[model samples]
Target: MSRTLIITNDFPPRSGGIESFVHELARRRPEGSVVVYCSSPAGSDDAADPHFDLRQPFPVVRDAARVLLPSPRVAARARSIAALEDCDSVLYGAAAPLGLLAGGLRGRVRRQVALTHGHETGWSALPGASTALRRIGDTTDTVTYLGRYTRRLLSRALSPAAAVRMRRLAPGVDVERFRPGAGGGEIRARHGLGGRPVVVCVSRLVPRKGQDTLIRAWPRVLADVPDAALLVVGDGPYGPRLRSAAAGMESVVFTGPVPRAELPAHHDAGDVFAMPCRTRRGGLDVEGLGMVYLEASATGLPVVAGDSGGAPDAVLEGETGRVVDGSRPGPVARALIGLLRDPDRAAQMGARGREWVARTWSWEHTAERLDGLLGAPGRADA
Candidate 1:
């Protein structure tokens, strides 16, 4: 059996799309010996659950007193990889601090592959200290982008060799867990939104997510479809501002920080999914395909997303869902109104999206692809 080590900055204890991706990949690789090396905030009490067979945690710090700082953490990680007696391949989850470290160990490892989620490459120049990390991460050998647009972006940023190594790999969803026929009414009834047309938007409450844009578009949406109710799921730094934005809007509901296990119900509760992700100034904010789009699609919900970053790849324009231009609220409101106004077409589109996802984007298929890569000659050990 091949042995693979996945190095990522976040994992289960820390919640996010990258963490979920690593966890799902590890779960499906039961035939191989899989271990994960993750970074978390200091003093986090959450321990690694034994069910997954993860390695002891490694903290990625931003402070002093550590033997090796973030710059050298990859080197330390390389030593850790070397110490893994029979490991064959190292899969760096994303670039940057981890990617830079993985790149530095090119000569040391037999095989090294890097995964690039959309926003990491497109919106790296955003304000904050993360820009420095993004610069370091841009040096990986093989980069896997979530969509074609991201592949082009990375190719422009890196050399011919690095760009040639880049490939587009769509992220997968748990089909069984997030199916269309499951508990739809229970979620809606629980939230007192019986028989209402629920428009769901699931994402971190970040500036780039365009939750504010959705909020701004709500009044127009409600005006066209009076019974329409907007349900915003997940939470983040921009939560307060979003709440304030929706204060007087009776049709808007903010379900802050829903648990991962309960996420399926939230998706089931929606008649349509709205993801208006946009690029913020200074390249600080952009969408990374938005995994929630896939989840909603799997639940047979039509999507209305902005044509920016990786969203186009997930939302097939006018077929599975509508992808409007990202510049203004008018296009978004129009798309939502069009879908909500015509229930028959919306249902048809939802059914199509669900079938597309079931046939194309499941964790089993994603694992098979990754497994094929791991079984390659030099990566047999990983």
Candidate 2:
């Protein structure tokens, strides 16, 4: 069987939406058919988790650098790996600077595919970065986008042919792992949230993710539903700011980055899931699809999504949940309050959301799509 070189900066034991997406897709590929070439996880030098690579089914080659760029040395190493492994294709985990390596790997690799997430949307707007993005689109056989919002912006930066070739490859949820009754009781009991109407937001505590907005809106939600508790999960640079935003609120709890295995239970603990994400830096910083919304939906929780970029794409409006203006505390508060106040309505929406996720956002479906894409012939074959 022909093999593929998975070239990426994003991979586990670093955690994020893009990292998870890439790792999931690569792991799902046929055994021995994939070989990963990724940079070392963010800190701790080359000595970082020695068993991370050993645990993988396929070979995982780690670069010494903490972050891999398309610099001459990095590109040279990628090309050498592709050649050494006899890889028929090259898969770039995040398109942008790393995808720039596609130009160097062209004739050597039969197929080259680059996956883009939220950050690429920012790159599409800048002058120099936009040109580089166009080049990446030009060199790679395909450039996959997360949603319509990203596609629309990226299309402007890509050549007509590249734009025409752009395909939707959004993240997917694991139905079995994230389904209803996935152990929310323990999470609630641990957090001292006994019988309270809980609203959970699972994401990196960040400015754009609107955790601050949710914090600001918590007071209004409490005013309407006094028993309601706000659960903020995950940690980031914005944690301090978010904590400050929630000061003096006893009902507000921060889990501060739980293990990945515990995330599903965190979602399960919430009666309603909300992330009032807003686009910042003009349109540059935005949500690509808000996979957490889909994950929340899969866990049978009614979502309150922000109307930023492609985040609205994850919701079915009245059928699943409300899409609120993430910037303002009033609309976000009202939305959360409305959902918290009505148990029957929220349950109905949650049920509908789970159904929608099972039908449209399963990891099986995404893996199949990626399998077909990888199997498709490229320019070299043509």
Candidate 3:
């Protein structure tokens, strides 16, 4: 392949799972081999990574929310960039938005790739959005799902032929950044949690993230281990409600939103990591391969994640962490208390997690895999 153009509705200095994912992908690609058409922040003061700009040309930065009356300007801009750069492959960060925008131009690109994380298959609620996504899946050369759970769901939603072309890519972790045995003592000291087994929930406080469930289960954990602490490290729209639920509870501390840069130490301060992601009673929206679980594990922390969604693929049960019914107080509390009780066991698990991540989940590995797909792809089928 000559070059690649990654068109995305996600980018930095905007913060979210997708933004981080896109940045990782862009950063890992071989220098000067890719161009990006993404949401404008490359235009803002926050987006001052000049070295990245020198490598991956930032051609178009459009308001992702603004859709044309009929045609998508984002897609049009990406096509124009691909033409100018003579790109051989095109990558869309998400199957919705950018992928939907590229629906009509699928045939124009040689290797059209769309990545799906979760929920967007049916959660968009936009007129004709589902149809557009189907077109995206069927027409794109490969539809990359974040994990088996997402691939399974999306495969069911499209034609069998299109489903056969589906691929799965688990998001990667920066092992160098979030390694085991880092200097996490300062965070612990600052929080006054010296030597207390901390259960950290380092995600946005959304209902889907299941922070509330963790809060409800805390009392039971405290009953089992009175000195244990729950460090809720993120903030979202559910802030008021979560604070209300944890009100008057001395063990529960909400640190609001911590920057992504400062997250590793917070993970270091914890003995066990948790995010009991829960879906609404009858909805498909839930965790789509929880990357934070991998981050926690990379920091040499034991994990406790929900059994639902693509999260299971990211975590190895009975090895690095435990997967339980996070929606329920009993399971969540039991999982936390069990890990907190035996520091030796938890430390072993964390060590295993770090080792496993170093072997299997590095950003370099994911980048190499993607580069192969976009590059030589030597197999006859490829």
Candidate 4:
């Protein structure tokens, strides 16, 4: 059996796109040879969840401290786990501080691979620190990007050999759990949204998520479709700001921090999914692939998202969903309005989207591809 260790900064109990990807990948991994090393949130237990073969937690530091001291106790923790499991390869989920540790442990292991969910190459860090880590990542044996945009960015930032080794591997959705006919009516009824056209947005309430832009566009959406309601799922530091901005909109419902188990219900209850993601001020944040767009598509819901990052890749223009420019609210508002007005067209798009997801982006397919990579000679640590 070939043992693999996944090192990530984000994991369960601290929900985000990367966290979900890591957990799901571990869950669906082949029988008997996988472990995870994650940076735990302060005050959280370091115990391993029984579901995973091994879970090692390391102390996490703030961004400033993380950049200042890139090599933390986490490096030792990762090494210890790799040693214990007799791991064949080390896979990194992102190029954060945790990735630095994994890259540092290269000589101690047989093979090393880094996975880029989004913005790894383009993202800016403290000058000296960013350059140092980029050098390390560029020299790693293999690198994986979740989208073409990310792959391009890494190609520019890394060496020719490292960039060539970088492959585009999109994240997968659990089709069975996030299906079209799963929990539509039940979720709507439970949320007291009976018979109302719902527009759902699932993402962290951060500036890049463009919750404010969505809220601004809500008034226009309501002008056309009075009974339409907006449901905002997930929460972050911007919760209060989003709530305050959304004040006086009776149709707007902020369902703060819904657990993953209950997310399918939220997706099913929606008539359309809206994610007006934008580049945050200073160009610091961006969407990698916007995995929720695929999840929304899996539930047979047409999406209306900003034309940024990998959104265009998943949302087919005038087909499965509409991709509009992020700078303007008119385009986004029109897309949502069009879908709301034509339920038949929306349903058709949704049906096509479900088919596309089933054939291409299911988690099972992702696992099979990863299995091939992991099993290949000289591809892993062993």
Candidate 5:
């Protein structure tokens, strides 16, 4: 059993999509099979990372990172850890810094893999980022993408030979943990959503997430179903704008930021999960395989996602949920109202979503695929 070194800029106690994804990836692997190198959450000391405890059984080394990638300090420490662990393989959570680092260790690391999400897929923008991505695509054993669209985006960065190395590996949810009937009623009661239909949106309050668009559509939703409640969970810089858009709407509730352990209940509390995500911040920021959509679906809540980016990959249109145009209030309003009004139909959709999640996505299954790609003998992916 060969050991692996996973270098990443993001990991918990940093709460984001990538942080959780990488944590699950390392968690499900065999004991002693993986060692992690990651950055501490902003303002927190490295010792504060929850998984760094010796009793946890895995070695988690904390370092620093830049906005786009881990700093040089992260790369230097990662190299030291690779040598110390005698790791046979190296996996970068994203393309930059670590991917750039992996390039310098071609002969040192036996197998190298880089996972590309949406933001870093654009090779032409960031200075030297294209070279970093190219190195991973050209030299690494595999370059995995979170969704089909993300893969297509990354393929643009690769040459003909490098394109052959591209692979698909989406983030998965803990189905057992986020299943239906897990204290959902408690959350509903806690939020004073007793007997009222609930629509929940869980994401950072950002322009790309389209919380403002959802708020704009809520007026139409309110006119039709007066008892309907819109719960906007999570907070960010764009929150003030969202709140302003939703001004004087009594039924619209902003829970701000909830704890992670309490998230499953939040998902289950909703009759429908809605986040009309679109390309924003001048069309650069995008949603790539929204794991939140999967989590909501896994909780047996029908989702209403955006049509842009790779959101379609997580949402099975009409099967588990609907992907609507996030820009227009008409389409967004219609989707929410339809789901809120048709309880039986919503329930049916939620049930299908639960089934789809169980059949299609799980951390265990995702880990198995990752294991095969990263360490399986006789598997010549590159």
Candidate 6:
């Protein structure tokens, strides 16, 4: 078994899609075969969570900085960790900035793989960042992209050699954890939503995520289906504004940051899942394949995704769900109304989504592709 060094700024105790993605992949590697080098979360010290590292199956070395840059100091530390662990491969959790360490660690590791998410697409269009991306491409063995939309943007910033080496490594959902009948009954009853039509939006309460659009469109949804309810999940800086927008509307309920274990049940409580996310800041901020859409689909719920970046990639338009212009509340309302009005059609779409997730979005398939990228041997139980 070969050892691997996982160099990343994203990791557990810090919350976000990338953080979860990196942590899941690292934990799945063979026990004791990986060593993680990550930075501490912002506003926290080494004592943030003393037992966090000990609970991990592999060693986790934390840097004092809140964010790790690809400076000489970080490079030297990464090289030291790689050499000390005798790691044969280096996997960068995110390509930009940190991927620049590839050049410094070339001789220390046999293979290097950097993963690119939605933000990298924006970085590819910047001046200095674009040049850094090109250098990262020139040095790393492989750079993984989440979907075609992101790949198209990043390809223009990478060298010809690296462009050809780009691969897809999308996030996968745990089917067993997020499935139909996963405690949804209790959730609905507890919330006094007994058998009422519910549409759920699970994501940070940010403007780009279109929770505000959903709130703006709620009146139309109520006009069409007066008994319909909108369930907004998760928390963020935009919560106050969203609450204000949804005020005086009892149909709109905000569940303010549910625990991770309760997420599947929340999904199950809804007839449809929606997050009309839109690209903002002239494409600088965008969705990176929308893992929440896949998780909702895995839970036997049809999705309504915004056509931003790779968000649509997670939905099989017309088959499993519908994609709409997240900025327009009219279309979003219509989509939700259509699904809510026709129970049979919604159920059929949900069934197709569940099947799609089982066949294409399983963690097994993602783990297999990851193994191939890292040249890792197959685990009988994986």
lDDT of each: 0.72, 0.90, 0.77, 0.74, 0.80, 0.90
Query: How well does candidate 1 score on lDDT at residue 249?
Result: 89
Rank candidates by TM-score, best first.
2, 6, 5, 3, 4, 1
Whole-model lDDT, candidate 6? 0.90
lDDT of each residue in 1-382, candidate 6, tens digit only: 7988999999977778998899989888888789999998765423555567789899999999889999999999999999898899999999987999999999888889999999999999899999999999999988889988988999999999888888888878999999999988888887888889999998988888999989988999999999998989899999999999889999898989887789999999999999999999999999989999999998999899999999999999999999999999999999999999998999999999999999998888888788888894322221
Query: What's model 1's TM-score?
Result: 0.86
Off by over 4 Å in 2: 44-49, 377-382
Better of 1 and 6 by lDDT: 6
Write model 4 residue lDDT over 1-382, tens digit each, in one string.
7878877666665557777777677777766666766554434323424323234232222221212234656577667777887887877776654556655687777767667766664453346545644675665666677766666665665666665666556689888988877777887877788999999998888877777788888899999999999999888899999999989988998988776788888899899999988765444466777888888999999998886676677777788998887767788889899999999999999988888888989888877766765655334211
Report the number of clashing residue pairs per model.
Answer: 7, 0, 0, 5, 0, 0
Winner of 2 and 3 under TM-score: 2
Error of 4 at 184 (Å): 2.8
Question: Each candidate's TM vs. the true structure?
Answer: 0.86, 0.96, 0.90, 0.87, 0.93, 0.96
lDDT of 2 by residue, 1-382 (tens): 8899999888988878888999999898988899999998866423456578789899999999988999999989998998888899998999988999998998998888899998898999999999999999999988988877888899999999998888778888998999899999999999999999999999998899999999888888888899899999999999998888788999999999798999999999999999999999998888998999999999999999999999999999998999999999999999998888889999999999999999999888889878766877433110
Ranking by lDDT: 2, 6, 5, 3, 4, 1
Task: Give the per-residue lDDT digits (tens) of candidate 1, residues 279-357.
Answer: 7664545666778888998988999888777778888788889987666788889999999999999999999988888
Give the range of the ten consecutive residues with the poorest summed lDDT in model 4: 59-68
lDDT of 5 by residue, 1-382 (tens): 6888888877776778887888888888899898987665676524455445354558877654433354566556676888889988988887754677766667777898887777875552454866667766777778787777877777777666777766678888888889898778998888788978999998888888888888888889989998899999898899888888788988999989888888898888889999999876554677877888999999999999997788999988998889999888899999999988898998899999888888878777788778877865333222
The weakest ten consecutive residues by lDDT in model 6 span 373-382
Q: Is candidate 3 or candidate 6 better by lDDT?
A: 6
* 5 or 6, greater by TM-score: 6
- Per-residue lDDT value at 59 in model 5: 89
Q: Of models 1 and 4, which has the larger lDDT? A: 4
Ten contiguous residues minimizing lDDT sum, candidate 1: 59-68
Q: What residue pairs are clashing in model 6?
A: none
